[model samples]
Target: MSWRTARRICRPTARRRRKAQWRKAVDAVAGGIERASAC
Candidate 1:
Protein backbone atom coordinates (compact mmCIF):
# COMPACT_ATOMS: atom_id res chain seq x y z
CA MET A 1 0.00 0.00 0.00
CA SER A 2 1.01 3.61 -0.59
CA TRP A 3 2.20 5.73 2.34
CA ARG A 4 -0.57 8.32 2.09
CA THR A 5 -3.29 5.69 1.95
CA ALA A 6 -1.86 3.82 4.97
CA ARG A 7 -1.66 7.01 6.97
CA ARG A 8 -5.22 7.99 6.21
CA ILE A 9 -6.47 4.64 7.43
CA CYS A 10 -4.54 4.85 10.68
CA ARG A 11 -5.23 8.48 11.54
CA PRO A 12 -8.77 8.30 12.89
CA THR A 13 -8.16 5.58 15.51
CA ALA A 14 -4.93 7.21 16.65
CA ARG A 15 -6.70 10.51 17.10
CA ARG A 16 -9.48 8.84 19.06
CA ARG A 17 -7.02 7.09 21.36
CA ARG A 18 -5.23 10.36 22.07
CA LYS A 19 -8.51 12.09 22.84
CA ALA A 20 -9.56 9.38 25.24
CA GLN A 21 -6.20 9.51 26.97
CA TRP A 22 -6.48 13.25 27.41
CA ARG A 23 -9.96 12.91 28.87
CA LYS A 24 -8.79 10.30 31.34
CA ALA A 25 -5.91 12.48 32.43
CA VAL A 26 -8.23 15.41 32.98
CA ASP A 27 -10.61 13.32 35.04
CA ALA A 28 -7.79 12.03 37.23
CA VAL A 29 -6.60 15.56 37.92
CA ALA A 30 -10.07 16.73 38.76
CA GLY A 31 -10.61 13.84 41.12
CA GLY A 32 -7.34 14.51 42.84
CA ILE A 33 -8.26 18.14 43.36
CA GLU A 34 -11.60 17.22 44.85
CA ARG A 35 -10.04 14.76 47.24
CA ALA A 36 -7.45 17.30 48.34
CA SER A 37 -10.12 19.87 49.01
CA ALA A 38 -12.15 17.40 51.03
CA CYS A 39 -9.28 16.54 53.33
Candidate 2:
Protein backbone atom coordinates (compact mmCIF):
# COMPACT_ATOMS: atom_id res chain seq x y z
CA MET A 1 0.00 0.00 0.00
CA SER A 2 1.02 3.62 -0.55
CA TRP A 3 2.08 5.85 2.34
CA ARG A 4 -1.10 7.93 2.03
CA THR A 5 -3.29 4.84 2.24
CA ALA A 6 -1.39 3.58 5.27
CA ARG A 7 -1.76 6.89 7.06
CA ARG A 8 -5.48 7.08 6.36
CA ILE A 9 -6.05 3.66 7.88
CA CYS A 10 -3.79 4.09 10.84
CA ARG A 11 -4.88 7.60 11.84
CA PRO A 12 -8.49 6.80 12.67
CA THR A 13 -7.58 3.63 14.50
CA ALA A 14 -5.14 5.57 16.63
CA ARG A 15 -7.69 8.27 17.28
CA ARG A 16 -10.27 5.66 18.28
CA ARG A 17 -7.88 3.96 20.66
CA ARG A 18 -7.02 7.29 22.26
CA LYS A 19 -10.70 8.14 22.66
CA ALA A 20 -11.42 4.76 24.21
CA GLN A 21 -8.62 5.30 26.70
CA TRP A 22 -9.96 8.74 27.59
CA ARG A 23 -13.44 7.36 28.17
CA LYS A 24 -12.10 4.59 30.34
CA ALA A 25 -10.25 7.15 32.47
CA VAL A 26 -13.38 9.24 32.81
CA ASP A 27 -15.39 6.20 33.88
CA ALA A 28 -12.82 5.29 36.48
CA VAL A 29 -12.90 8.79 37.92
CA ALA A 30 -16.69 8.74 38.08
CA GLY A 31 -16.67 5.38 39.77
CA GLY A 32 -14.22 6.68 42.33
CA ILE A 33 -16.44 9.67 43.08
CA GLU A 34 -19.45 7.43 43.51
CA ARG A 35 -17.63 5.18 45.93
CA ALA A 36 -16.35 8.12 47.92
CA SER A 37 -19.83 9.64 48.17
CA ALA A 38 -21.33 6.34 49.22
CA CYS A 39 -18.96 5.91 52.14
Candidate 3:
Protein backbone atom coordinates (compact mmCIF):
# COMPACT_ATOMS: atom_id res chain seq x y z
CA MET A 1 0.00 0.00 0.00
CA SER A 2 1.14 3.56 -0.62
CA TRP A 3 2.24 5.58 2.41
CA ARG A 4 -0.39 8.23 1.68
CA THR A 5 -3.17 5.68 1.53
CA ALA A 6 -2.07 4.09 4.78
CA ARG A 7 -2.06 7.50 6.46
CA ARG A 8 -5.52 8.31 5.18
CA ILE A 9 -6.85 5.12 6.70
CA CYS A 10 -5.28 5.86 10.05
CA ARG A 11 -6.43 9.47 10.17
CA PRO A 12 -10.15 8.84 10.59
CA THR A 13 -9.53 6.17 13.23
CA ALA A 14 -7.46 8.60 15.27
CA ARG A 15 -10.08 11.33 14.89
CA ARG A 16 -12.89 9.03 16.04
CA ARG A 17 -10.92 8.05 19.13
CA ARG A 18 -10.25 11.67 19.96
CA LYS A 19 -13.90 12.54 19.50
CA ALA A 20 -14.91 9.74 21.86
CA GLN A 21 -12.51 11.03 24.52
CA TRP A 22 -13.92 14.53 24.22
CA ARG A 23 -17.46 13.21 24.60
CA LYS A 24 -16.57 11.36 27.77
CA ALA A 25 -14.92 14.46 29.17
CA VAL A 26 -17.95 16.58 28.37
CA ASP A 27 -20.31 14.12 30.03
CA ALA A 28 -18.22 14.07 33.17
CA VAL A 29 -18.15 17.84 33.32
CA ALA A 30 -21.88 18.07 32.78
CA GLY A 31 -22.51 15.60 35.59
CA GLY A 32 -20.30 17.65 37.87
CA ILE A 33 -22.26 20.76 37.06
CA GLU A 34 -25.53 19.03 37.84
CA ARG A 35 -24.21 17.74 41.15
CA ALA A 36 -22.99 21.19 42.15
CA SER A 37 -26.32 22.78 41.29
CA ALA A 38 -28.14 20.27 43.49
CA CYS A 39 -26.06 21.23 46.51
Candidate 4:
Protein backbone atom coordinates (compact mmCIF):
# COMPACT_ATOMS: atom_id res chain seq x y z
CA MET A 1 0.00 0.00 0.00
CA SER A 2 1.06 3.57 -0.48
CA TRP A 3 1.93 6.00 2.26
CA ARG A 4 -1.37 7.77 1.75
CA THR A 5 -3.31 4.57 2.26
CA ALA A 6 -1.29 3.71 5.35
CA ARG A 7 -1.84 7.13 6.76
CA ARG A 8 -5.56 6.94 6.15
CA ILE A 9 -5.75 3.62 7.93
CA CYS A 10 -3.74 4.88 10.91
CA ARG A 11 -5.26 8.31 11.19
CA PRO A 12 -8.26 7.40 13.32
CA THR A 13 -6.19 5.42 15.81
CA ALA A 14 -3.66 8.20 16.05
CA ARG A 15 -6.40 10.76 16.50
CA ARG A 16 -7.96 8.72 19.30
CA ARG A 17 -4.67 8.37 21.10
CA ARG A 18 -4.02 12.07 20.77
CA LYS A 19 -7.49 12.93 22.01
CA ALA A 20 -7.06 10.69 25.04
CA GLN A 21 -3.78 12.30 25.85
CA TRP A 22 -5.23 15.76 25.39
CA ARG A 23 -8.16 14.96 27.66
CA LYS A 24 -5.86 13.57 30.32
CA ALA A 25 -3.67 16.64 30.17
CA VAL A 26 -6.63 18.99 30.30
CA ASP A 27 -8.16 17.15 33.23
CA ALA A 28 -4.88 17.23 35.09
CA VAL A 29 -4.47 20.94 34.52
CA ALA A 30 -8.03 21.65 35.56
CA GLY A 31 -7.61 19.62 38.70
CA GLY A 32 -4.45 21.45 39.57
CA ILE A 33 -6.09 24.79 38.97
CA GLU A 34 -9.02 23.89 41.17
CA ARG A 35 -6.73 22.87 43.98
CA ALA A 36 -4.70 26.02 43.66
CA SER A 37 -7.76 28.17 43.67
CA ALA A 38 -9.12 26.43 46.72
CA CYS A 39 -6.11 27.62 48.66
Task: Provide the TM-score for each candidate, comma-separated.
Answer: 0.87, 0.75, 0.82, 0.92
Tens digits of lDDT, candidate 4, 1-37: 5999999999999999999999999999999999999
Error of 2 at 37 (Å): 0.7
The best candidate in terms of TM-score: 4
Model 4 TM-score is 0.92
Q: Rank the candidates by TM-score, best first.
A: 4, 1, 3, 2
Question: In terms of lDDT, which candidate is stronger, 2 or 3?
Answer: 3
* lDDT of the candidates, in the order given: 0.99, 0.98, 0.98, 0.98
TM-score of 1: 0.87
Per the 3 Å backbone cut-off, how many clashing residue pairs does candidate 1 have? 0
Give the better candidate number (3 or 4) by TM-score: 4
Alpha-carbon runs more than 4 Å astray in model 3: none
For model 1, the stretches where C-alpha displacement exceeds 4 angstroms are: none
State the displacement of the C-alpha of residue 35, model 2, in Å, after optimal TM-score superposition. 0.3
